[model samples]
Target chain A: MAANSRFAVAAHVLSLLHIHEGGRITSEYIAGSVNTNPVVVRRIMGMLNKAGLVQTSPGVAGATLARPIDEITLLDVYRAVQPEDGSLFAIHDNPNPDCRVGRNIQVTLDTAFTRAQQAMERELAGMTMEEVCLDIVNRP
Target chain B: MAANSRFAVAAHVLSLLHIHEGGRITSEYIAGSVNTNPVVVRRIMGMLNKAGLVQTSPGVAGATLARPIDEITLLDVYRAVQPEDGSLFAIHDNPNPDCRVGRNIQVTLDTAFTRAQQAMERELAGMTMEEVCLDIVNRP
Candidate 1:
């Protein structure tokens, strides 16, 4: 399966908005930096907008951060662009109920996978867009 | 993107081998419990074999774990079945070099993402197939 890059693109879009605060940053301009299509940037930006991370006027080329950079966690950005299900791992569907292991495996695996996913999310939650922007600015 | 169910299937397969220990657990039998095809079971078993997690004989219908269930962690099973790249998140490719954030974003995201992935892996590493088996056996 192809790796999902929506999280990465969303992060780039947000970083650009934060760094260029008070400026009109368009999808086309963000696309230039991401080296992808403006449509792709707009699509991700739409998710951010829906998540209330950014505000965009109808037919406008630019958007503004709805929350301060420090308040927006990477976890928030990840969830915004991720599918609504938002599970980091996928469980198989429909194991046979006749089999003991099959009957119980889903619940068993769910417990473990949830723990692992939460561990990752906790890390993302601890990190903010402010930290990301600071790292970008400090880069040589 | 479709949710990747390989991890769940692999865990289910391994649990069967453990629960039905001392029995010749064929791919067909495993498939019945997983509610998948024998071909799917064999394909995952092939990966486990290659990862040294299981031992399979040519033209054989069954296989055995390479180590005790207590010695095998979910992280081991996860890595065995995961794509070689194994990154949970993907970064956008080919950002413009002319853009400062673009040039630096990859590295910045890498550090943060790696931490999150490792956090999840560490959680997986802490939990063993033994724990999973116990959970399965204890289920009501």
Candidate 2:
């Protein structure tokens, strides 16, 4: 499977929103910054809205952060945009039951994968949209 | 993109090798246990070999661990199978530089992502093939 870029794209979207807070920026504009399509932005926006990270009003042309930029962590955005349970690792569902490794692979992998995911989330939780926006404005 | 299954697949290969050490196990057999293709298994094996985690010899139908399972960490398997610098997260190459957020996004993302990758590796480094194999055999 190809690597999913949703996390990067979603973080990009949030940073843009943080930089342009109080302004009505369309998904097309966000897509332009993200170098992707408005449809993709909208799909991600829909997920973000559902997760309450961002909100879209019926009359609004674009979305806005539901809370302050500093209040939203990358982990929040990650969870918002991620599909399913959003586990970064996946164990093959069916393995040869007769093989000892195959029979126990899922449980063993799941334990390790769960820990890796939590570790990743901890790292992400330390970063916020405000921090990203600040880094952009301060970049050399 | 779908989540990559290389970690689980590689670990599965390692465990099977551990359980049947000194015996030749074909890629076909490993694929059967993984429920993936022999080509997929071979591809992973190639990476493992390059990492010096596994050894392949002439006339041998299968590969074996280069080190004891207790000495091989999940981090080793992960590094073996990952492409490029093996960073778990990737920032898109082209973000709209005209936008403040876009201009600095990559650097900002790289910093966060690098930390996330380190955290994940730390978690993986704590586990070993021996532990995984034990989990398998102990399962009801």
Candidate 3:
């Protein structure tokens, strides 16, 4: 199965908004850059809108970043596009309680998984959309 | 979609083997502990086997750890069950080259995503099956 690409697409959309700041940038325009369907871009925009990362109107042809690009971290974008649960790893369901290992493995894995997830999130938190846009603009 | 549970299941299977070290612990027995189908257990066992983490034979009812549990890190188990590509994040495909951001967003995202993925992996690498088993054994 394809890994989820919502985070990447969201970043792309936001970068485009920053690059074209002050211009009316439609979902169709964003989709063209992302090489995805406009509907996909709109759906992500809705999530970004709800997250307060972007501003959109019911019939508007364009969206804008709600905050300065420097204020939005990749973590914010990642969380906005991901499910609220947002766990990086999934523990198995319903281990046999009668088994000692099964009875406690979930909690054990949870502790370890949480650490790993936080480590990743910390890296994301350190990177802002401003940096991403800068990297894009500076790239050859 | 449910987060992939193969990592949890693989860990469970390995823990079972460690707990029942000397006995002929069949796939059905491991499945009982995991509360999943025997086929599921066998399928993961196949992956663990191919990863050289376990020793299994055709028509065998049980498997054994290929190395000491202390030597098997969660990262090892994680990589064993994950796809060869094994990137934690997926960048969207085919951005429009005509667009400046599109031409460079992938490379920028790749750098950031790699850092996040590596941070998570390093945490996993720090944890071994021994610690997990110990955690399970010590749980009240």
Candidate 4:
């Protein structure tokens, strides 16, 4: 159960599209750039497509960005691939109810964890695909 | 891996110690509350001990918190078990260097991820074990 690498992979796929905007790129090409399999790249792309961050057509073998890179924040990309109800941290289910602390731990942690999630989202919102591409292109 | 439950598990171990202040508790007991194996509890406790958040006597049978619950923030617990130099998000290594995006993705992602990590730490810093335990105790 490794931390899902989908987010990293999604970002990489997006970066490649940004670098090669208007170019018809297949999942195989994206997979090669990401150094992962085409299936993984396609899965992430599927999520990205559902989120309307990217566009794909049935019978079409290529993909493209649905919006300008500057308009697409990391937060948007993160949410695009993130599990709808999953938290950054998960409280273990079914703690011993006989124990007072166990009986109440989940609720307690849920509140704090929500705050932590919001904090991370705020940071992600501050970064966009355009800035990421600029940083990469400007690197020596 | 599996989103690293160390933070939640560590908090559980601490809350139990707070509820049973001055009482000697074994890893097996904590494991029972955590619904996991004693080995896992011991591993997490070892981290807490190394962080100076908890005290363990060599050859002794149990452990306890080293500081007041209020003084032990979630940040302390997190740092105690977090992999040093690990980021919340990891950029894929060896992205196709021939591609401009691949050449610079790591550096750009690293900068953005670092900010996200700091934000999470800041939020964790604001929460203490005392607050956590109080919330649990006060729950209906």
Best by DockQ: 1
Model 3 lDDT, residue A97, Cα? 95
Worst 10 residues of 3 chain B by lDDT: B1-10
Chain A TM-score by candidate, in order: 0.96, 0.87, 0.96, 0.90
B26-116: candidate 3 lDDT, tens digit per residue? 9898899999899989999999999999999997667889999999999999999996589888898899999999999999999999999
lDDT of 2 by residue, A30-134 (tens): 989988889988988888889899889865785878998899988898788777777778777689988778888998899988998899899989988788778
Which residue runs does candidate 2 get wrong by more than 4 Å? B1-3
- Which of the two candidates, 2 or 3, achieves a greater TM-score against the reference? 3
Candidate 4 deviant stretches above 4 angstroms? A1-3, B1-3
Docking model 2 quality class: medium
**DockQ (C-alpha) of model 2?**
0.70
Highest TM-score scorer: 1
lDDT by residue (B40-135, candidate 1, tens digit) is 999999999999989999797668889999999999999999965899899989998899999999999999999999999999999999999999
Interface C-alpha root-mean-square deviation, candidates in order: 0.8, 1.9, 0.8, 1.7
CAPRI quality level assigned to candidate 1 from its DockQ score: high
Number of the top candidate by lDDT? 3
User: DockQ of every model listed?
Assistant: 0.90, 0.70, 0.88, 0.67
Of all native A–B interface contacts, model 2 reproduces a fraction of 0.84
